[model samples]
Target: MTTSSLEPSEIDLTDWDFWARPLSERREAFRALRQLPRPAFFREPEQSIMPTGPGYYALVRHADIVEASRRPQDFCSGKGAINITDMPPDLNEYFGSMINMDDPRHAKIRRIVSRAFSPRMIQRFEDQVQAVADQIIEEITAKGSGDFVADVAARLPLKIICDMMGIPESGYKTVFDNSNIILGGGDAEFLPENDEEYALKLLQAGQTLKDLVEELGRHRRENPSDDLVSALVTANIDGESLTDQELGSFFILLVVAGNETTRNAIAHGLKLFTVHPDQRELLLADFEARLPGAVEEIVRYASPVIWMRRTATRDTELNGQEFKAGDKLLLYYWSGNRDESVFTDPDKFDITRDPNPHIGFGGPGPHFCLGAHLARREIGVMFRELFRHVPGIRSTAPPDRLLSSFINGIKRLPYEL
Candidate 1:
């Protein structure tokens, strides 16, 4: 298995140049990578237009991605932003979520929310998930034809996570828009009506999150409950309680991370079914028994979170290629899932593909997607209901991909529910 370096000539701007194109165009680029002999990561060369002031490399191969994600010690997730650029210092100071933090602190924050995500808790939530999914499906079915993205996929995950996080149902629009705009503001089209307006939107979103955290913090203090916010407020590690900053950071994380990505996966999964009717048929046939594979395949294919970055702690050799310290590594999980070396018939969508080890959920390791099990449950149950209730569902209009490449999901999926 020989892996060749990407030549300067081969480095067309469109070679994984997701940031510069429309979602439709970007999906074409992803389709093209499927044909590449080996997985390739996108990077702005030092002389190229995009700057790497923060500094890192993009890991595009299946094996290298697995390595980079698993061994956080050597390739830490804390040095810089998970996306292509760094978050402003003040923004990071306020909204620094758990995914970016390294161990000890990362471990501590993870522990606070861990109880809510425990297997027992998750299993208990199955009925809630099913009920929510069923209700959403019923509404979709009643319409007979509706936008899957807006009517079904968008509402389910956001509502579930909002309920779990103790967020008022009314705050969802603010939370959803804020999450998308903040993470995806880089996309020129996805920016608010205007750049100046978009900036204001971002500020308001951050403030809303701040207010939410402070209010929830107070609620948790006065009358603790089993909800994640209260659990987090009450959690203690080595006699160290989560500070206001930490709690605020995690509250944003839980809301954003819990909602957006799952919503994307559900939306994208429905889109994939429209593309792969056979897989859809198979899933509909044996949904109860085969739902697990369908969920895994959805994560593998859509990979809503397209890439995660890691700054090299020191020089490292990945796939026999040496990367220097301070090099920014962008692990393209989307490309990895389609790697021919790891998956058979890589380009073909196979919901039943067994032994699937795609890193759609952050590969297999400690940082391997803490909310994965819950995500799976949500997707699986939704699909089961979708296939059963909205049997005739299909996309009525083309998808509008999120403007930002960081969170790769459909911004608008016009469809018949």
Candidate 2:
């Protein structure tokens, strides 16, 4: 239900080339959208299509996104959380997990999973994170140079999350390979020849993940251990526990959403350090004092997961624009994090920037990232390890970014340590 508000020529969100552009160009496009008074309607292109149930409104402003996320009752997520598309309810259930849920079910699953991250567990994960960061750096530096994504960035979170899930070392590559393809959008390296092949490829990857979780869930249920899967399988909230499907779905979410994001952020952190060496020096000068803020700044700047979707439950108006029941909206965190009204010199990557108010972890809402605490620790530890050990490390070439509007990921980053 687009109105006079939309200026179609301004941009096309559905274009593949748009997503493949350099970071600067992409940010500029989003920055331009922020000036509009209302969210713009986007029509998903037909040729390179997705199963987007309804057209989506691009919510680019900080205020609008914050409002939509806060008012989850108005803008729901039960249909699906990916902007511009909606998966079938059953598929969304398995893949989207609690992220695609609303209210009772969302709360129920979150409560059970939340228990897995008790303070003691977070402390333990933090200790293990530091160890993994040191090990990754030790391994990478030993090679003198390596692809930062595989050698360094991807390893820490992959190791930590797999360790937490009790996934054996033999299966690390399986998890890693599947996740990359799942989130790769339509990148040729990951995606196949056509839509039919792509669907099969995605299904194969997804099935592999599900099989792993089911196998692990069965083992953990009988031989319960201190791992997250065991905690989840045995968890009880209000006399209800996660069903095998729910447990498997949640595990899928943790592996894909959990590992993919932090991995990209750490990769981006290294690239950012090389690009803005002064920012690196600021952190290097007083690693302890600046580390926390640096992590926030990096997340704000990188915004690993770009946008999340919300479906309108009923007719509503935001920023003076009318939205009908069932209208889909995308909360573009990347744009909101860079909104000029909120951030002073928003383009500048300032490690000392306080009152950040970034939506890197989604905005203040029920759906904020569950692994944010652990992610921050991982990013902080990795940088601490990098600066301390590989003092002269720098990216030798521009990153080969994954062709994804959804995930702000670097597929390959060449570096010299």
Q: Highest TM-score: which candidate?
A: 2
Overlapping backbone residue pairs in candidate 2 total: 1
TM-score of each: 0.87, 0.96
After superposing candidate 2 on the true structure, give the runs of residues whose Cα lies further than 4 Å from its correct spot.
Answer: 1-10, 47-54
Q: Give a tens-digit lDDT track for model 2, residues 67-143.
A: 99998899998988963666667878877899899998899889998987778777888899888887787788789
List the global CA lDDT of all models: 0.72, 0.86
Instruction: Please give the lDDT score at residue 85 for candidate 1.
Output: 57
Compared with the true structure, what per-residue lDDT tens digits does model 1 show for residues 54-130? 44454566788898777787787775545455556456545547778788778877776675465665666666898
Residue pairs with backbone atoms closer than 3 Å in model 2 (clashes): 52-85
